[model samples]
Target: MVQHSYAVGMFPATLISLKVKPMNNQEHDEAVLHRLLFQINMEIADQTPKERELFSNSSSHFIGPPQRIAEDNIRLGLMIVLFLAGTPLNVTAMMRLRRSMLSSATPLKQLKQHLNISDLMILLIYTSSQIVWLITVDWRSNDLMCKLLKFSHALCFSVSSNVIVCIAIHRFSMVFGKSTKRVTTVSLWVAWTLAVATSLPQFAVWTVYRPYETATWQQCVSIWFVREYDIRTKNKTLLAEPLISSTAYSVYHVLIVFWIPAALLIICYLRLAMVVSKEIYCECECVKQSQSTPLTNGNMPSTDQHVTSSRRLLSRIISFSSSSSGRFEKALMRHQCVTMRRKRNAIRTCLLLIVAYIFCWLPYNAFFLWGLIDHDSYQQWHNTSIAFLRYLIVVNSVTNPFIYLPNFRSALCSSHAVQS
Candidate 1:
């Protein structure tokens, strides 16, 4: 009878010792089991065998640590520095170009009045809208703002891309006098229309998602709900489900925004390159004439000095322009160099400016394509790469004017010096 009483006392003592919180499946079952053993060891101080054995032999279960997020934060910091530094350079450069556009005379019958001050304003507004999405939009408290925020983000990216394309096309056409027809006015409308059409799908499909009924917030906004859709088994898409919104987004991006525009831009660039090269040859001729004039006499230099200097200058010019293009008309451009080189110093600065743009922006293009590749390089590259990519995108946008505006400041200063 004493043994039975003692055994009953043991049960209460063991129950009192067990004090553990609930854990995930892999956890020490640290639940009542761990607590019970601990209690037993403490209560039966003299024996102490059972609880020690359980603790010694227990399987360990630890949740993974958060290392990845920490790595990303560091990378993002570096990018922010580069991004900030380049922004003003880009704006100042674009402004220089704007000044040129406004002051420069147009030979065309119907000049584009739409381009005067509006393009810059549009670019500023679009960039500001994107900044709001990247910095402030949180769906938890504001569903409407969130949707509008995402749509604005997509709109800015698409419009900027298309607008750049329009700028490239317009610049190329004006430089070369390719089409006699007044096409710049029509092209602006077309570019905006395409931008809207491309961005519309993102607005149509994106929606705020509430994963937990009591969580008081929605999470995971984007066309890529990859994991969510991967886990989903429902055959039908619902307006209410986040997965459906994501699936539509994935399809839209894959088809409309990325693939189609990439191909079109490539063709546009090719045409532009050809036109620009031809224009360079003409500009080189102009420079050659300018160089032939002696600095003091204002009379043309002797033929021998003219020929030698012209050839050297032309080689420099062709090399500068064709190096980035990789599709230089070598055989054709080679003959032009002799006559062109005498004028080399005239446009040497201009050619170098173009080279800068190609280098800065081309790597960005490669990186952009890499983002779409289904490979581990993108996933495991650490946060550093993503941070770099983010900075690169913003930097490219801002650095463009600075790099591409050939002979911009020098030309202006030279003109002023001449006036003085």
Candidate 2:
């Protein structure tokens, strides 16, 4: 793999060299490679059939494996499990939350107005693409299905990334109390429109018919990525000829999901934390003052008395906040401001989701980058390692949704109980 990586055509060198910045990450990459190799070696007890052929009959001058197909099945099966487990929870939660917000007749009625129907549609389409691609037949062997699959794949992948970016930006605006209306409107339209636009190149560049040896059938692929080297390379990236939009899609993901958006997430969260912390502190101080002041007696108040006094003060303050009376009006304005900030706490949550995506998918992206570069290194035995790594990475996606379930247990329980 290293040897082929040094040579011209494989995906790694292009990926590696394409970067403008010299990586401080090489050591990490090397360590990761070692771990992957060790895992692969442990999994495969024999010389792989694919490696054996590539070293022997293959003109590509590769080593090991007659086929990595079985290894792929194992890896993909695990991914499918993790992915399926995740979808129901994360998507359902988002869907339900949005629905709840929209249906509410409560004070947070603003939430309904902000829930863009287009963005919701985009999210659903993206989720659908994931599930659809998982269940569909291997389209690589057939012309029509190949194009359709590739197109939908690109649509799902790109739109999801874009939507995430939009969501993050929207939340950022909300958190800072900026012009959320503009951000929301822009992001909503861009998310769906670009989603449709991104799918076009996938259809355009796809040949629809793939070259397969007599031994090959319409079985699912060993590589989930046979991405093109350049969008215009007109050749295979690793093992597959992806659409012309492939390079663009990869670049967008790397930037939005990994680099640019990640930095923005950190910044937004820092700002949000500062804002929320200040608000909490102010409220805490006011409440403390109210609690500390005795009835001119400085005597300790009974617990119930303290609670009643606090509730009464809170109610009076809340009511005063709606008033236009001179001195009380200023207090009212402050209260309204704080109340608005609380509603915007949802923005902080959006940034956190960005953080979550970074943590969850970073390994998978790194693996893809490294493996594609080292495709030559990916002998029959190497496939086992790649498979194992892929399984672990995909597991993140599944675990993400379930991991948060515990946090929302009360809500889930209430929803279930209500239904029951």
Candidate 3:
């Protein structure tokens, strides 16, 4: 009896035995052994189709189908557009902001400039990764690189979202607290630190995973734990589970990225609007009272002169009430006017940003949540919807400059004129 062993791809080695009749010739024994090996090869070849069928069936249940090539081409084209458009827009916005800051380095202007910087970082990180994905089939070949890319994408997104929140908070403080300066250097540093800390978990949760154990391509996917499944042949297979639970992570992401910021923005802007309306109403009343005041000469004053005389009379009344009170009232009114104007401008800029954020991010987050809740149904349109949503998110970065740059430039020019 002669025994031979052979190993096939991803399969255990097996031994086959060949029995030969008694032969005195060594050459004949060798030839018989060769014939038996050839027969074994033919049998193995005949079994290849069944093995492939099993693999295909098992893999289909987990890995799903590849994305349609037409959809992929469209997605790639859109990503290229984002890269071309967002890059230049962000760079231009950053430069314009820097130039303005050089001329007038106020706390508010600095905060706005910092926001531009955050958006720029987000555009760079996300667009670069997206471009790589579009260009390469197996971009996640290296585990370390995969983890780093996923971490960076999350970090940039969190930082940008938090920065928008910071802007809202800063405007709220300035409007309600009657403060000129908001968002100090310390506060900005703290905001960024928190953002970075919030995003750190991504590095731990994401890693390179092989959807098919023997497949050449690897995916960068979120992995919580190892799960084992028994297939038809009693073969056990392992799959990666999500670390934070898909539902939990989806809820957390939506809350942090969308709901909280949207709520804060709405509340702050509404309160600020009411405050401005009240101030304008009071100013109008003061003007009417001034206009109604009779002149000693009994000659009606022109509109400009009437306004000036009314202000003077009010000042006298305020001074007569108490000199310190009069001075305080004048200073307060001046501060209120300046702060209110700045607040209105800030609100306008922030409203555009918040609206853009919602428009771009909400659908994507909603889809993600839906996928988590009912993955089977969601998988039907997963490739198409996700690709579109991702492009929409990138569009936000591209649109920000167009939406806010004009306002920023006009504000900058107005400030220069006032300074002159």
Question: What are the lDDT scores of the predictions, listed in order?
Answer: 0.39, 0.42, 0.54
Range of the 10 consecutive residues with the lowest summed lDDT in candidate 2: 35-44
- Per-residue CA lDDT of candidate 2, range 236-285, in tens? 22322332234444445345334564565567667766776776667667
Candidate 3 lDDT, tens digit per residue, 1-420?
Answer: 222222111000001122223234323323432111111110111112122222233324354423324544665677678888778767877888788888988766677677777677766776666656655534346888766766676666666666666666676676566454634565677678876776666666556655557665554544431121122113322222321343355456556655676677677667766776686667656645544652332243334444765877755654455555446656666766675576567778777877888788777666655644564465457444555665676677777776666664476567679999
TM-score per prediction, in order, is 0.50, 0.53, 0.65
Please list the residue runs of candidate 1 whose C-alpha ends up more than 4 Å from where it truly belongs after superposition: 1-83, 90-102, 105-141, 171-181, 223-262, 269-378, 382-384, 406-420
Q: Candidate 2 overall Cα lDDT vs. reference?
A: 0.42
Q: For model 3, name the residue pairs that clash.
A: none
Q: Where is model 2 more than 4 Å wrong at Cα?
A: 1-68, 90-95, 98-102, 105-141, 179-182, 195-199, 209-253, 282-348, 368-407, 410-420
Q: Number of backbone collisions per candidate, in order? A: 8, 15, 0
Better of 2 and 3 by TM-score: 3
Model 1 residue 385 distance off true place after TM-score fit, in angstroms: 2.5
Q: How many backbone clashes does candidate 2 have?
A: 15
Clashes of 1: 8
- By TM-score, who's the top model here? 3
lDDT of 1 by residue, 1-420 (tens): 000001101100111122233335432232232111111110111111212212221222221211223333443354345445544555555556556667764422122223212233323443343333233222344656645545554555455455454544555565565662456657667866876676565454445544334534343233333232322212222324543443344445433433455555566656655655676678677656544532332232334455775877755555555454333344334556753552343233233323433443344334434433432343335223433433343454554443345564586567669999
Better of 2 and 3 by lDDT: 3
